[model samples]
Target: MGKVTLITGASRGIGYALALEMHMRGHHVIALARSEDKLQALKAECNDNRMECAVVDLGQPAQVDQFISALVDRGYTISHMINNAGALVNKPFGEISASELRHVYEVNVFSVFELIQKAMSVFADDIHVVNISSMGGFQGAQKFPGLSAYSSSKAAVASLTECLQEEFGEKGWSFNVLCLGAVQTEMLAEAFPGFKAPVNPSEMSTFIADFTEGAQKFIRGKVLPISSTTP
Candidate 1:
């Protein structure tokens, strides 16, 4: 069995591009997302036996557990896992509902936690887990309005990455957080209309894919800011 890289939110944007980039680099990719049609489109575009797509909604804990359990039963060993799926609620801090906040945290933070916990059974010896965060979540970065829930949830993810590293770094499994800046993703467009990001999804995904594959060599248990402009 070849080493497998699992990417969440792989139906579109950065996840989709990263899946393709990983495939080009000879990786067997397991792409997970909520959109079955979009995932199938990605699979068709890859046109490679190495690319596998699954419909997964990261907001649901039971679904995440089931997915990981299936991977474990299949004897799959994950060499790299990118927690690239995120949820955003673009509402004022005062107007954000309890359910909306919970949904944000559920997808951005809770899902990553559950997935990583369940995935431990199938982790390769040299596994690297990259948690994708946002520039708004980075400490001391320029803050923005209408993203209280989304930003705070991302902060939780970044902190969780550090905690995971501390607990597992001695085992030689690497964990890192990438606080990303503005990227031309559909999500971004939805969050901040009329804003043109500095880099497109393809460009940012190329950088992220390379870093995900190589960052463990030089750094682990660190949070790095990946951005050219603050949004």
Candidate 2:
């Protein structure tokens, strides 16, 4: 059977490309996002039931929890889980409200934790979790403006990925954090204006999707950086 893959933020950008690439690889993909319209368009583009769409907003974990429960009821076991949904904050730290920071964590870090918790409860031993992090989490952590919340949350996510890797991955499962550089996405556009996106979403997605699909072969429990700077 094809590997069952579920990707968050699947409406556009890297997520959309990842969904399409996974379906092309013969994996049964559950493309998730908040916009049902984009999901419909994604479904139309794929034209295969193997590429299904789930309306989920990661910031709302209760809804995602309910959706997971329903999938469990249907005996659907996800082989791969990609935590790709996130929020961006571009204002000064003082200007960024508490609620704004809270929601950033909610979507980027907290919801990932919740999803992993749910996945652990129901998924098989061979399941893999891939957390998509940012170069901002490591490099320019303090250099960028208005990145205090966004970067720190992703840094937390990177830490959580390591923790989860140590806990579950060392035993049997595969858990990884891929710290990606500037990709051609809306998020990148906001982070650094005028600098052209060094990476194409489709190319990035294809590389990362393949990496996610066969994580056990190359990596086990670690935070690896994928950047143009890397040889």
Per-residue lDDT of candidate 1, residues 1-231 (tens digit): 576999998988999999999988889999999999999999999897899998888777778778888887888999999999988989889999999999888889888998899889899999999999999899889888999898888888889999999999989999999999999998999789999998999998889888889989999998889989879
- Model 2 residue 57 distance off true place after TM-score fit, in angstroms: 1.7
Clashing pairs in 1: none
Clash pairs for candidate 2? none
Looking at candidate 2, what is the lDDT of residue 52? 89
For model 2, the superposed segments whose C-alpha errors exceed 4 Å read 139-142, 229-231
lDDT of 2 at 194: 70
Every candidate's lDDT: 0.91, 0.83
lDDT of 1 at 67: 88
Model 2 per-residue lDDT at 88: 89
Error of 2 at 80 (Å): 1.0
